[model samples]
Target: MLITFIISSALLTLITLAPLLPSNHWTVRVWEFPRLQIVFLILINILLMALLIAQDLGPFLALVIVNLCLLCYQINWIFPYTPFANTTVKMSKSSDLSSRIKVINVNVLMSNRDAHKLIALVEQHQPHLLVTLESNQWWQDALEPLHDAYPYRVNYPLDNLYGMHLFSRIPLSDITTAERVEQGVPSIHCIANLHNGKQIQCHFLHPAPPSPTENEESTERDIELLGLAREIANKQGSDSLPVLVSGDLNDVAWSPTTQAFLRISGLQDPRIGRGAYNTFHAQYAFARWPLDHIFHSEHFELVSLSRLSEIGSDHFPLLTEIHLK
Candidate 1:
């Protein structure tokens, strides 16, 4: 019994930590560490109680190490989401409409070569802005017809997995990429000018997954995103500015790390109460979670959000429209 408990507890801890390893699928991977931790703690407590009932101090003392591990796990789990509340009580603000913006973010696999489907999605949604990840020159050339409609463009096509491109019908300004952490990986950050002359900062990101073929760990990608969120949150009146951080975040909405990012950045998820609109590996519908996300500051209200039909890519495009206050 002692050996069984020791082995099972150790195995659970190892499985919980396994996601720390790199993998392209790490973004959507669900590591139920919290539940595992709870299970172990409950088991340990029950064991101690049983031993105490039998008046056998040996087994109780023997399980001391496992108890300590559970304590540590609980400590980490207790970390707060974010310092800011969901909505500020001091500022009872109404939603914005003049600053409305619609965006489409898609990770069109480089090998997809099905630009026609992408074009159809664009024509159907008519998003104010469109950002594509894993897009190469082939994708850039395929999407040429869109340039005529969406005059503003930012193309940083790379053969590397991090290729990114952006097209917007609205005027965009202050366009720049975070070159430091986003080496070969390309991201588009800019300010969009609405019809009402409202300017909102938009960021499109597609970080490398933590796969053996890609990054060794998701820490760098996760940290970079969290850092950006913190920067946005620190900005005074950031909520009023109507900032949007969207893309193939490669992380699920339920992940603790992803939730922390949302809290620290003062961003609100549009998918609250919405079903998990999984986007990746569309072929395997059952194995899907909401990998792509659109997180925005408080000033906007979600008008529409959905996943488009498959377009010969592992990922399905996500479209979100928000009325900006």
Candidate 2:
């Protein structure tokens, strides 16, 4: 038992620290998604080691210490999502009706056909803007009901899972879509009108995740996100508009690449000090992470962030309300 615990504990400890290297290999990048699960494993392993202390006291002590360190590193990255941390975007203290904007982002699992669930959410929340990922021609037809309410839209539906669609009640101008990282994987860039007649620069993305079925490495995702971040940060420097990027980022909020993107873009994450707001794996409680995200500039203040009811898709809808300060 002691021998087994030591070997497993040591291995887990190394896996936990793998992402720290400046590498985007699939093996290293994949480690970014399971920090929370690793923490649980570390805790349980520590308890097992303590109970089996009779085997090799010295080795067990070293393993326990390493596990503890790994635990701290993982928690530090996630601490921003906890209530104890301070929020990056502050909601307006005043009841400013004209400056408010509501946006919802959802990733409709490509194979799932529950269009009504998503349409119902749009009706219930009445978001100023709605962005959908993994959308296709059928999903577009199912969502036709939104046209009456949201006259302005940009749709790029495809049978491939990388499809995207955006609908807004407010006018959308300067709209364009691009395949930032790989061909056929499009990202939307546009400007939306706020209640007070202000223009908010918006960018929506659904970066391909690093997986065996998809790209074998995180290179494409990182390049796409970071490249856009640099551009947004450049325009954001003028400080004339409130830049907002919302969609299924396909990356966790706490990952190193995500943090680097934020720093490069100078965009503020509303999830900071709020909560994990895990949107993926709607069906599984054991395996989940905050994959969908809304990152905006410091020009706006956060109002409320909440997860909507399950829509039969693997991801639940995320609703965010913000006040343009």
TM-score, per-candidate, Cα-based:
0.74, 0.96
Question: Tens-digit lDDT track for model 1 on 84-111?
Answer: 2242212224355456688998989888
Q: Encode model 2's per-residue lDDT on 1-325: one tens digit a residue.
A: 6578768877987898788788777878888897778888888887877776756678567778877888898899888988889988886675987788899999998888889888888998899999999999998899999999999999999888988999999899999999977998999999998767898999999999988898888899989899998897777556568889988888999998899999998899998887899987999988889999999888888888999999999998999998888
Q: Report RMSD for candidate 1.
A: 6.9
**Candidate with maximal TM-score:** 2
Q: Which residue pairs collide in model 1, if any?
A: 22-210, 23-210, 23-211, 24-211, 27-250, 96-324, 96-325
lDDT of each: 0.74, 0.88
**Model 1, 20: alpha-carbon shift in Å?**
9.4
Counted clashes in each candidate structure: 7, 0
State model 1's lDDT.
0.74
Error of 2 at 91 (Å): 2.6
lDDT of predicted model 2: 0.88
